[model samples]
Target: MTEMSVQLEQIAVRAARGVGDALRAAFVQAQQPSHKRDHHDLVTEHDERTEQVLRAELLDAWPDSAVLGEEGGASGDGAVHWLVDPIDGTANFALGLPFFAVSIGAVANDQLVAGVVYDVMRDTAFSANLHGAYADGEPLRSTGPATDAQNMLITSYPGPGTLAAGRGVEEYTTLLREFGAVRRMGSTALALAYVAAGAGCAYAYGIHPWDVAAGALIVQQAGGRYLPLPDTGRPWEAPGYLAVNGDFDLPGSCLTDLLPRMLPRTATGTPLPGGGLRNRP
Candidate 1:
């Protein structure tokens, strides 16, 4: 990590650890859950409190940076914006599950430069900046070559009906069957963090900017690659994303072929919007 990246990472790590600390304290006593407008979506008092802690810590550390969080809404207009999901898997957390996580990232000039994902239950923190990615302070990197069909694949289904919600489900289904095994962890940020730690080989989902901003930066720093998912003709928005280990070559991987079929396309074979895809929870 360069000097700047190290400094920025420290700021992000402190904020993330603070979120974890709050979660530990607030959740230990049990939580009162409330459903979001969406029936399947859930939140808790802890979520709001954790966001409050994170926002204050981040804002205090970098007052000029804007903050876009799931809880407190968006604030500021700095060149560098911080995107956070106070608890990425609130549904799981509310149900006494340990899959929930705190996700935070710094975006500057439309690029994600640093991020942190803290898993409260395990006290594990995943972080990254221009320097690289880490799991509990241990440097992380994607494992093996990307072509192995036996590689682990992580996806987020949210609810039962959403699996087929995107483009070319049939192709994705085929890919799933071919891979070693598939995991639907419900938490986009944590799933991506696992990928960054080499706990999984690949991960993809229809994710919002807040959900992925941090993890994506971690993946890149950990020697992985990600970009907007190809549009499937639904809408031209910040497309969902597909990511793979940095060592994985598209030429020999199934993803290279699958990407074209899944991306949104025009009647004349033109691609749709490649940026600004945000799915608000």
Candidate 2:
């Protein structure tokens, strides 16, 4: 790996780890979340506070960097752009569920070079660079069952955006019947991290850069497939994604027919009315 890639990965980890303690303390402490888009899309004070801290830390560590955060829009302008989701699963965190995480990714030269996804309550760090993906510093290999009939599928589909596009339910129904199992995990970042750790084939819809940038690098580094929906040649910027486990046969799976068809046209129409990624019209 280049020295820059390794350095960026360390910087991301430090910035994410720096905020773990504060997140743990406020995990289930009567957080009153307000609607961002709706009740389905929520944000807490902790989310803003954490993002501020992270953005500061990241920029301070690498002065030649910018940040595009979930809570805060693009700030600073440099070669290294940092994508951050201080609280990836805000709904889960506000509801006293232990599934939220901190996600940070470094994009330089329009390519993802380094990233980290920290599971706050669990204290596990999933990270990646040009070299490979790692969970708490151990190498990862995203192997799983080859076919959908025998493998698990994880997603947050049928979301407000998916439903708005009028395509998710029928496709979801097909997934429900074809996959061996299905899980609707609130955190897209963690779902991708899980896929990198050999958990299951997963998909996410209408995600911002902050949501999947880190997880994308981690999944791809772990010997998995990161398919950017709409396939605009820029996985980091694309709003939709699918992360399949290493051994999974994506072409043989049901997803090949459903999501790829729905995304290109649907993503442009997916609503992001309140407090979504800026300049996404």
Model 2 lDDT, full chain set: 0.86
Which window of ten consecutive residues has the lowest lDDT sum in model 1? 272-281
Candidate 1 per-residue lDDT, tens place, 1-281, comes to 25656666779888888667667666656667998877678888888888888888888888777888887899876776888899998878877777888898887655567888888788988998887899888998866445547566676523344344545567668678767667777788887787776654544544677888788788878987665454443211243666666665545555555555554444214342333222111
Backbone clashes in candidate 2 total: 0
Q: What is the lDDT, from 0 to 100, of the residue 237 in candidate 1?
A: 25
**1-281: candidate 2 lDDT, tens digit per residue:** 36799999999998899999999999857999999877789999999999999999998999988999988899998999999999999999999889989999999888899999999999999999999999999998998889988888988777776577676788888999999999988998999999999887887767898899999999999999888765676788877777889999766777656654445463555442222222322
How accurate locally, in lDDT, is each candidate?
0.70, 0.86
> How many clashes in candidate 1?
10
Clashing residue pairs found in predicted model 1: 1-131, 229-240, 230-263, 230-264, 231-263, 231-264, 232-264, 233-264, 238-276, 238-277
Off by over 4 Å in 1: 28-30, 157-169, 201-205, 230-237, 260-281
Error of 1 at 11 (Å): 1.0
